[model samples]
Target: MSTSTGGGVPASRFLFLGTRAGHSIADAEYEAICHYAGLPTSRMDRVRLEEGPMPQIDLDRYAGVITGGSPFNSSDPITEKSVVQQRVEADMSKILDEIVARDMPFLGACYGVGTLGTHQGAVVDRTFGEPPGTGHIELTDAGRADPLCVGLPDKFDAFLGHKEAVRELPSHAVLLATSGPCPVQMFRVKKNLYATQFHPELDSTGLIERLQEYRHAGYFHPDELDRLTREALASEVVHPQQILKNFVEVYA
Candidate 1:
């Protein structure tokens, strides 16, 4: 046989997907999100994609997928993401389509909740949601039963930084986790597809830094900064980062 230009297939890779929306800067805010999620912001495994469409990365080559939050609400006005954001969302839609078709392993956090929710036909209108301060997150009965939150203690601490939440779950999505303020904090679809309403990827320190950076962007009010930041930094409930390790273990 003629010598082939390509070698045998390489081992599977893991992808950490992130999106930064308007007024969402790169340095501290972005980096901290990655850090909290157990992702290497410094490495190739971590890819910061926009809110729109995504590329077609091979499922066999990548172990799984991870998504981060963004300022673009799945319920935003048409003009929210701008041209670039719009394009990115479109691209990501293609990628997500592939993920669904192949039943690929995936985890979506924050904005992922919205995108996945909207995609799955869940009403994404921001009627029953508001950003809340740090607090203990408790899994619902269904949440405790899920593989992702299974044996994860009925109660745990997580850094929650979001503006909107699921007013209702998609038709087939199972309700998995919840906090005091946000009931639809976590859910799953078709077994492998998952989404979290909280920032499961970040720790307290990372969150504190992010709070300072994304403070005015709207996670919290400027006047509430001192109290909110201090409480969030002192909280020990943000163990959802372990969820990343757990996901890597289960999928990859």
Candidate 2:
């Protein structure tokens, strides 16, 4: 299902593209995106890509585009991916072609690393996969100066959970943030296209919701759910959402 928030002018609307199969999960993610971006529910619009083909995009119609996490991994063998996953990736590639080619404003979180990295020729594999938990990030010199990094500390904590990660920086991208386990935590393509391996929209509560739904998704052993939940609640993650807020402020 797709949702359109009513307050923003058509030209100022921001599109959130989601690839989740579960409506509840996708809805939660969407709400978080709107929350952190400081957008009222009536202003941020969403498109659930798993529900159908991506509609044609007119970059000029919206101020910017944002995509959130998904269970789909680009590193999964083609033979192993579900038909829906394959279609979603294909659709995402088409949109990326337009976004990248035009240098349109965009921010992609989590699953975005895989899609955007693959499109930019970066090797996204299991080599740097990090477990679901708080991640420690240190900004590169370039990242410190990036407009999106404004008001963010050089080093801060953010919530992250992924099964695959970018093994190296893409040739056309500038490295923005780094973690020991995942060196390519964030990067920018051209000037406006950005992707983060971490979830800027997730907090302890958000992470717990995902853990409950994905307990059996191989992110971790199902038996660890309780402990993971406790850890998530106890974790102090304070700065990543600034990226989302910055994206909206800079572009909108």
Candidate 3:
């Protein structure tokens, strides 16, 4: 985690808000985010929401904010959620209120789509859920012109696996990218707040680690690990990381 000195947090540093529970998963997620964003560990501060209550954040301390995927489903019944999940959601929601209102620079991956989408009045449910695998992403006319999609191909494969999705684009959002199963692959709210249905931070090794961590978490059958690992390693997924890089370049 990055820290502040007696003066204040440096403006060039970025903060990654993580929601995964296990220490290894959380650490790996932060590492992958920094790796893909071309940010050194020293330049990226990590807040692991699963560990405890989130502290009041001073947004001015960092260049931007990024939230990682979580096992907690936004669409889950309130009664079905665990205590930690409820607290984490509340903490995320509180921060989002300020982030969205101020048009803060934020990029949410996978589960972030749900939180940000829900905050913006978009419906997020299990309707367009996709299995764990690589999916085709097509950049929209707007996507092609968007700075975040600058170096990306018109169409490419990205790793995605979620139990819920943004069923429709929020009224105030710009549809940046689309995919076959899940149409709202990426969208921008206001000028700086962004969300993605895919995991841009994931490489083959990272994906393998996540798959193992969540194997019993219901994403896929435990028996499929062998095949998933093979396919994951064989797949060429080099474009999505550009999103992370673009975000960091534009914001930092």
Top candidate on TM-score is: 3
Model 2 lDDT, full chain set: 0.90
Model 2: per-residue Cα lDDT at residue 239: 92
Query: What is the TM-score of candidate 3?
Result: 0.96
**Worst lDDT 10-window in candidate 3:** 1-10
Q: Per lDDT, what order, best first?
A: 3, 2, 1
Error of 1 at 123 (Å): 1.3
Candidate 1: which stretches are off by over 4 Å?
1-12, 21-44, 51-56
Candidate 1 lDDT at 133 equals: 53
Q: Write down the TM-score of every candidate.
A: 0.84, 0.95, 0.96
TM-score of 1: 0.84
Model 3 agreement with the true structure over 1-252: per-residue lDDT tens digits: 223333556788988899998888888989899998999999998888889998766777888999989999998899999999999989899889988888989999998998999888899999999888899999999999998898999999999889999997767799999987899999999999999999999988988998898898888889999999999999999999999999999988
RMSD of 2: 2.9
